[model samples]
Target: MQKKSCGFFSRASELQRAPFINLPLHTGRAPAYLVRRMIRMSHAMSKVIIDEYGQVEFLRRLSDPLWFQAFGCVLGFDWHSSGVTTVVSGVLKQALKLDVHGISIAGGKGKKSTSAKTDILLLAENFGLSSAKIDSLLYANRMAAKVDTAAVQDGYSLYHHVILFDKCGNWAVVQQGMNAENGMARRYHWFSDNVQNFVREPHTGIISEKKNPCALDMTAAQSQENQKVCVDLAKSDTNNLKSSVYRLAARDTLDRWLGGDMVVDVVNTSGYEMPRRLDWALFKRIYDVQPGSYEELLSIPGVGGATVRALSLIAELIYGAKASWSDPVKYSFAHGGKDGVPYPIARKVYDESIRYLYGAIEGAEIEREERTDALKKLASFTTRMFPGQ
Candidate 1:
């Protein structure tokens, strides 16, 4: 992501009002310029986004929750706030207690769907679209693609997910999502199976607030039925997040980036320092590395087209193994959602989301001080809920 000099939406209307609001931060760390490296790098951001090392230092200062609130204002209170992207980029730092800078970022574009089909010209008959092009389509902004191209500093076609965070300079695929149009559910079998097993076995992690065994009790079987919602969602074809380039990197490459960034300091929270180099071997040992064997890799937890691409790249380039870059899933923006909507955009979820946000903001304003962090965030969300509003 690029660091942008976010000119305030307006100069005089800055006093905490409406969506583009501000807060009277009693305290804030150094000037944003001081930690220029840590700001969010968006495909659309034209400014010089901070690099990995600079991001680590910037996060150290944001470790204060009060600073978070204060900075939230300085950056504009909108989630789309110029600062929101930057803040989110570093927020994980505070919560995770790790420096993400210096981490290598990587991921692969599984497949591309274009009107054109070209298998005739290429020697090996590679498909028409490259992962990079797919990335352009998905990210639309090209921030990740730019970062990968710039930071890779190498000739080995990045072989993991299209995105990977190279923390400590060691690139590893920690989490990856598939993009193939049809196989995601089947590919995520590892997760599905494990969760299934977890439910079948004794689970101490989920504690109920029950006073009596029979008090408002649901049979274990029935409770498992309710838990199946997540399982069902995991398999859901509706607006799934599996193909997101960012999500793929966040999941697969998060550990690699976690350590290099000094994450905890970024969020002002106390937690273990993000580990140095997650054990990719752990995954490797448990799962077979059938490079380009999308069907096999998809069965592993956290494995997706991105993971397959990363592994295949490593296997082929680094280890001298050959693999294919065919997209793993069919690309679709709508996924399984209605072409338009079950209800019109002006009437359906859009209206509902706005009403809910407005009511929530109004209620908070009425119940407590009109100016609260909650209200500020609500305002931010509302702007997104109703763009022109």
Candidate 2:
């Protein structure tokens, strides 16, 4: 099969916008009746996708934010709610059978998210993956979470995490973070094939309605020099780093610390603050470990957002290596049809979509060639509708 191009996987232009999907934080569990229908619809849709495109391609589609959002809508979830991420993932987790689909999902919302390692090991053993391959998958899972939570210091804090993988170890990640202040959620997507370096612009796409004016994006390509400096500082003496922090904290004014006459916005100055509470013991441990790269330094246990921010500031202020402070969000959407901007979700239409897809898959089981051609036409139509996806 020929591979199709997806814009999210391309690294040619950093300025090009990624596909967008907004997720507003809404409290409430999806009704049991709605969830049951969603499970059935998700199972049918996933079956056809895996059967037609294979497990790897299915993983690729999940890594695309636009496709994932559409999938959530097709499953009858509120398109603009943060629940779309968690609900869709939860539905897929229950719907996809490893023995049937040759794929498995691990981790989930809140406390369930912490059990990913255990789930991965169990599922990998079932898949007969080698010890080394399983270990690599585990590392990938950990690093994906770490990169989003620390390296990219957007205000959102991750609350939901799930990794979808196939028998061959190809994987996709859909994790979401919440901004408690604004009550919005941002989602991060990752595909194994698209990532070459975990520390540099590694996300396939990041989706959010609100973009922070001054996010500390350490994973940005422009931050490469700063990343190198950060690694060097981590390997350097803790005393020198502490002295730099002290000097930064002792400054009387923001302009003096910034070394300019420029006025600083009081609200956004939180991003620029030199963290007064530095973990000197953690720094000592980091110094002992002597991580050769920023990624390695980040993978070290206990390196949270605070540590990453402090390091970036120190690198910029004292070492003359400036990190990028641009928010990494690619695009935004304010409303969803389900939210009654245009119209509410029509149950009859939604049910018809599910029935049509389910019936088509059942028909394909009997008339594979004709169904395949029809599916090709559908794909062509979708390409025309969503070009560059």
* Model 2 TM-score on a 0 to 1 scale: 0.79
Runs off by more than 4 Å, candidate 2: 1-21, 254-271, 332-389
Clashes of 2: 0
Per-residue C-alpha lDDT of model 2 across residues 1-389, encoded as one tens digit per residue: 22222222123332233323447899989999979877876776688778776899788778767557766765667766899999999999999998778999999999999889999999998999999889989999999999998888888999999999988899999999999998899999999998899998888778877667788899898899999999998999988876666565555345333322222112113347544345668888999999999999999998988789888887887678989998887531211133332333344533433344444445433346534543554444333323343
Residue 134, model 1: Cα distance from true site in angstroms: 36
- Record all residue pairs in model 2 with backbone atoms less than 3 Å apart, i.e. clashing: none
Worst 10 residues of 1 by lDDT: 185-194
Global lDDT of each model? 0.26, 0.74
> lDDT by residue for model 1 over 1-389, one digit each (tens)?
11111111223432233122221112234356523422321110111112322433332223222222333432334332223323433433232222323322222222421111221112112223355443322331122222222211111122112221212212111112221332121000011111222223211111111111111111133333332332232333322312222233443433333442112111110121122232344344323443332222233345332333333232333233333221111111101112222222233423433343334334321324333544565555544323444
